[model samples]
Target: MSYDRVRAVDEDVADALTGERERQNDTLAMIASENHVSEAVLEAQGSELTNKYAEGYPGERYYGGCEYADDVEELAIERAKELWGAEHVNVQPHSGSSANMGVYFSVLEPGDKILSLDLTHGGHLSHGHSVNFAGKLYDVTHYEVDPETGRLDYEALARQAEEVEPDMIVSGFSAYPRTVDWEAIQEAADAVGAYHMADIAHITGLVAAGEHPSPVGVADFVTGSTHKTIRAGRGGIIMCDEEHADAVDTAVFPGAQGGPLMHNVAGKAVGFGEALDPEFKEYAAQVVTNAEVLGETLEEHGFSLVSGGTDTHLVLADLRESHPDVTGGEAEEALEEVGIVLNGNTVPGETRSAFNPSGIRAGTPALTTRGFEEAEMREVGDLIARVIDNLGDEEVYAEVAADVQELCDDHPLYE
Candidate 1:
């Protein structure tokens, strides 16, 4: 983790690198999609495999000197298969979005219809936001969570599926706090004769540890980011039945991306190995427990959680109900000022702009990775409430900043 080598060659880059390391050590990273990979995973990601260009799958490469690349990729693929229990797994797509793209390419032609959750209601851009390529290439419709319950209505979704009759139905979410019923979604897709693609990008680790219901067997295709809840390095994965294995692999390679980042695949392999250990189940369980504690604490302070609470590692709070004057963007800035970093998120039935939305999303994957438990998470929730309650109070910021520093010291990272 030292920047000595970089400093010898490039002082500017080295300074930034060192500063980023220091910042991570100092702040509480509460971003829903972020987590700290172990040093082993980090080292694997920073390995010399970065120079490799093994453009194809194992035992079927397009170039020479791919012996090591093949080994790394095979190990990653095998580990991912074991982790998610898929008949076939592709550890290639450069990102989760790309993984979605690969799946889309494998089956649907351009202009084929897609049905997914609304982005403001917890969907990802790749699900078909107007600005994304998926939106441009596909005719996309949406299903919304029940406004009253703030949860999916399976019957309503089924009705919508029949009405839209989309070529595909995407399950999984970005900011949702509840566990998904993949079978329900699958049944909807079946009635409509549509493919069910469950994007478990945010809940990969939870699913792997059996803390959440997995979509591997229920959905036609499953995609996820390796880094989010899993603590794998930055990468995406695709899983499908053996029947679609060829199509998925080809789509991932020549269809969506070329020359996989083998270093990242190595990181995935290392992290997956770590996840297979018995302790990872405990870590995954703690992540959910901490999130519940955090959500409960926030609720105690008068904040209204989007779905009322969490069954996963993240919770989304709608500021409109409690602090009507404070926008999510404003709360995000004030929280960051005190070294607590999360994101301004858009809630269901959003009444504000996406940039400065009505909600804030907080998560516990990074905190749990840093050894934080329920008590520490509760304290964090209190600090967040204090900051949000007194946004412009400089004295309060100083007090919270001191407390954050103390918490950081108590649970040191990369030490």
Candidate 2:
């Protein structure tokens, strides 16, 4: 992992890279959108493929020296097809948001209506946030989770869809911690003569392992990020039926982006191959089990979890009831001081602003990737509660940091 060659050319950038690697190894990564990739996948991402420009799909590139690129991409597409069972797949979008953009360009017209979850309620910026291009280009409407239950009320959403009559209904989320009923959402879209684009960016790995229900056959189009729960390198993927194949391909290449990140496609190929192993399914199942343990442990410490608990790999703890004076940002800072890294996020029916919301969101993907299980997560949850409960106490911070360091040593990442 030494960046010796980089150090010879530029010392500052090399130091930062070394520091980041050390940091990951030493701390807990609880961010739900993050995961640790295998060294095989990392090598592929940093491969010579990045230097080559494969401007088109496999076997149909605009440039020469694409033989290897074609091989990597074809392998990636084939493995992805086997993983998700999509009729057509595109592995070229640079990110999950770009994957959504590819679908929008392929099927949606400017000013066409888009119905999606509210951003503060667990949706993404690409799903028509006002600051994002999707919002400016389309007419956007949003649905929220039930304030009392802290879960999606599909019946209310269906009514909202009928009233709006959007051209496309976008399902999937970034923060909500429950199983999405893709069929139910699809039925609403069908009732309004609209298409469904399920962006399963957060749950790609779960769906691949059959731990979570897939949206591939249910939604008209499905999108995901390769890096999140999936051990793939950073990139995006789109899956659709054969009917929309050509349109998606054209939209991805000449429409939203220019050249394919061939390096990432190679990484995806490698990671997808690893995920096909039987052990990956066990890993996925443990991820959910670990989250359950984490949420239960937090609840025992008097923290209130949104939806009462979770069905996914993450849990959202609303601090409004348990620690009224401690904002999510304060808890986040205190946790980080003790080497536990997670994000403060908006809760449903938030009373605070987004910048410093009323809740903390933590996940088990990176920990599970590091081989952590129920016991370790329960310990980690206790440490988090201690740090939040004693925010300004130096003694408590030091004790928690020591406990966190011992756990990190036991799990040992990137070794």
Candidate 3:
């Protein structure tokens, strides 16, 4: 029997899956941290490797019948290393956060001083957000982007590093939409004799395709999520200098997690292979183009953009001055009514709570991957602006929803 036919035997399960798929087909995913993987990646993820219990590295396995597993794991590591120009790559960490934890655990003592970017300024929670393991376990110093320029305050970071003399300095973010200067960050890290770690989770594909700066050779450690811009399956990878390979490997396995997920690793291998294609480079370039168009269009529409605009695939819009009456939460709901999906984010010095912030973070990666271009992005921006302008009007929302469906149908994703 076919898998779908067998699944159809359970009526409620089939209904649930069908309904969820319909939800995906209807909504536009503008979340920067999300993307739709190729069906090839999905197929590899559901392959027979799902039943494996490979606990050790390639060529030295803990289980029998490990030849193919060895080959797949080795290929993932080699491809990842070459893609990023890293001396060593450990593709075992389960998530970006997990990869982050591995780095901290591998290098620092429990209370060692660590410096990282602040969360409100586009840093991740795992980068010492006070609630995560990094903040709780390490002595953390945070730096923010300049309020006036809405960019990294590298001078302030340098001062903090010199003052604190931290053991490590982490440079990466979850909402930053500008380019990162590894040289400046490396200087700060060097000033303090710190190990520099750059998490390119949001821009791994961009870096792989030369759309963004590479931190592989510059930083002591680099980490990323495969599923985001990399278009890989859901997992994380950590790359480092060859000298730290064993430490990183131990950190990922015994220090942070147990057995690796072989199925996901297989999917990652497939993703890495796809990322090597020349077309992926074009895709990466288009991501930036679409973001530029959307940002320029929104600014022209009188919306206030954080950093004045974007240099990357994301655009963070300030809703306070643009649409003061509508909070980020309300705007999110309004856009959702129009089949546009995005996340509310905290603006710099935001007065509102996190649940209903003063900003919205949207991106073009998924749309660009679906073959949308600058023209479509302009239309998308217009639709988004209109939705924000008419957030409280149910009639406008219903009408916009129809238009969104038409637009999506005209340029169907994953077709």
Scored by lDDT, the top model is 1
lDDT of 2 by residue, 1-415 (tens): 9999999999999999999999999999999999999999999999999899989888898999999999999999999999999999999999999999999999999999999999889899999999999999999999999999999999999999999999999999999899999999999999999999999999999999998999999999999999888999889999999999999999998999999999999999999999999999999999999999999999999999999998888999999999999999999998998899999999998899889999999989999999999889889999999999898999999999999999999988887
* Predicted structure 3: lDDT: 0.88
Q: Candidate 1 at 106: error in angstroms?
A: 0.4
Candidate 1 residue-wise lDDT, 1-415, digit = tens: 7889999999999999999999999999999999999999999999999998999899999999999999988898888889889999999998899999999999999999999999999999999999999999999998999998899999999999999999999999999999999999999999989999999999999999999999998999999999999998898999999999999999998888889999999999999999999999999999999999999999999999987999999999999989999999999999999999999999999999999999999999999999999899999999999999999999999999999999999999989
For 103-181, candidate 3 gives per-residue lDDT tens digits of: 8888899999988888887889999878888889999988888999899988889998999899999998899999999
lDDT agreement with native, every candidate: 0.95, 0.95, 0.88
Error of 2 at 190 (Å): 0.4
**Off by more than 4 A, model 2:** none
Error of 2 at 248 (Å): 1.0
In candidate 1, which residue ranges exceed 4 Å CA deviation? none
Q: What is the descending TM-score order?
A: 1, 2, 3
In model 3, where do residues sit more than 4 Å from their true spots?
1-9
